[model samples]
Target: MLPLKGLSVFDFSTLLPGPLASLILAEAGADVVKIERPSSGDEMRTYHPRVGENSANFVMLNRGKRSLCADLKQPEVVERVRALLERADVLIEQFRPGVMDRLGLGFEAIHAINPRLVYCSISGWGQTGPKASVAGHDLNYLAETGILGLSAGADGAPVLPPVLAADIAGGAFPAVMNIMFALRERDRTGKGTRLDISMADNLFTFHYWSIGSGTSGGGWPKPGAELVTGGSPRYHVYKTADSRYLAAAPVEERFWQRFCQIIGLPQELRDPEVDKKAAIAEVQRRIAERTAAYWCDVFAGQDVCCSIVTTLEEAMDDPHVIARGLFDHRVKSGSVALPALPVPVAPVFRSVAEVRAAPGLGDSNQELLGTI
Candidate 1:
């Protein structure tokens, strides 16, 4: 009895944001029917370095989801989806704004069929904004929200982050939260709702530190000038002498004091404005003198919130992440390890395995056609 177990989601999203959102739902027990194209499939199949038929990007997202291939432009296929929409609790679409309306499968069309259906539109800029139709990715969204400018590095330019922050925050996080809220609302009103979440617009929340830098619009320099964006030594990455990086965060006075004490720095270096840079530089120099393994031992069992800059392989064994069970590997066969999810049963379906792999273009035609 996992949460969202019985609920069926018609997922028309591809690439990242929408699919990931639906994946979370699927992980939570939503019967997610990934409605991909009959030919090329979701653009994600062709994305990244391939890994044994599964795209690294696709597998990371599409686990526990069912595949249903149908071309919306074709009347027969559209009819099939329309039939499915009648029984669907949610419709997750990541296409541009007008594409749905063009397909005659917009919110109005679906609401007419199932008034209780939660319709979610995930996009880079949002559905109604002036920039909604613009083609953009995580970088574009981050740049638009002024968050990117804050992450300046030693080169004095914006640093490229490793995650799809905008897509995750604005698109996925909001999408799931919004749909959940709508589910609650549906329970009360017995009707559906429309959700429009924009990745570019939501970047403001991710840049809280940047936004907190200054109140006056003219006081800020887009993003790179902000407190959280490596502007202060308190929240920056430092390279050790051995080329290992130590990610430090001593934003508070108490933590800074402890950090200074651990590294044996002068008291005057405590003030963020007057001595922050020097303090960080000193820590960098001191930490550099030792290897990451040595500092890991040094910082172990400490509350300084200081950590080594670990790579993907190193991150898997990170203590906190391990404790939380961040990566759930259930089924393992020789060379393949598929992610297993045992989502708790609530009001939703818990065991949703409708679409397994990216299908062979209309692979489920017989199964879906039988339903119609």
Candidate 2:
């Protein structure tokens, strides 16, 4: 049996963070009932690239979950939702601080009805901060937390991240982890706790090395000055003759030596005493002399920790990724078949074949409401 076989989750969240957290729980065998709005449902359902009746984003995040449509403003509907909450083991929401309180489903109100509900609230700045009411997105949280400043380009301009790092890492992952911890604690005390997950506050955890150095009297690193950022030649992206890139991350001395030998670097330049700027330029020049494919072949099966920077499609079709069964599961969206987004649940707890397609808005309304 799955770890969360008998657990029930009432997910009153939309978009990415809260939905993704509930997705993990659903994959782990929790019975997740998504409580969406009456007609609009989750906002992500209307995103571009529709798969059948739902958007690709919504389908991927909401897989293996049932949905119940209800207008919380309606008195009867609120009672129906409250009934579900009484039996739910967890409740996840991503609204602003006072929105739930205004809706009459706040933590205090819900806890009174179900003491064992693990109530998780995901927001940008948390529930009790000066900026708590300020509206923000993933980039805003990264900027506010000083993480965006760490990712500046050579021109000293901050680069916008391609992915929603704050949403997934800062919000979803922490919510799931805390929910699991709260569940375990509930098992011991027979009561659940409220989890306030602030995306901005949580993002500082990713800056552990920088924070440690600064606290120890080493001043905070300037943009593009950190070893992993771009200061070191051994850990940067180098462009190839074909205009593609090669990621060289041989940080250890042994791997660095191997990489230098493979690139045919001069003995004097191999020493750390050489000018870092000059050394980095030399490495860049040498890498640009060959095509990405040539370097990929040279680094194949080597411990030099170098690789050709591949496109998303190429990475998905990589031999190792395919062998590991990373994209083995397919979910049917009407006539179209889409690959299932991977969840971190262990294979022993859930298999790819066991994953179900996302439910339509209000798909389980009749059945769920009847039970309530």
Candidate 2 minimal-lDDT segment of 10 residues: 347-356
Q: State every prediction's TM-score relative to the real structure.
A: 0.89, 0.98
Cα lDDT tens digits for candidate 2, 211-280:
9989899988777777878988888999999999999999899999999999999888888767878889
What is the lDDT, from 0 to 100, of the residue 294 in candidate 2?
Answer: 97
TM-score, model 2 to reference: 0.98
Candidate 2 ranges with C-alpha deviation above 4 Å: 351-355
Given candidate 2, what's the lDDT at residue 50? 94
lDDT values for all models = 0.76, 0.90
lDDT of 1: 0.76
Residue 91 miss distance in model 2 (angstroms): 0.2
Give me the displacement of residue 307 in model 1, in angstroms: 1.2
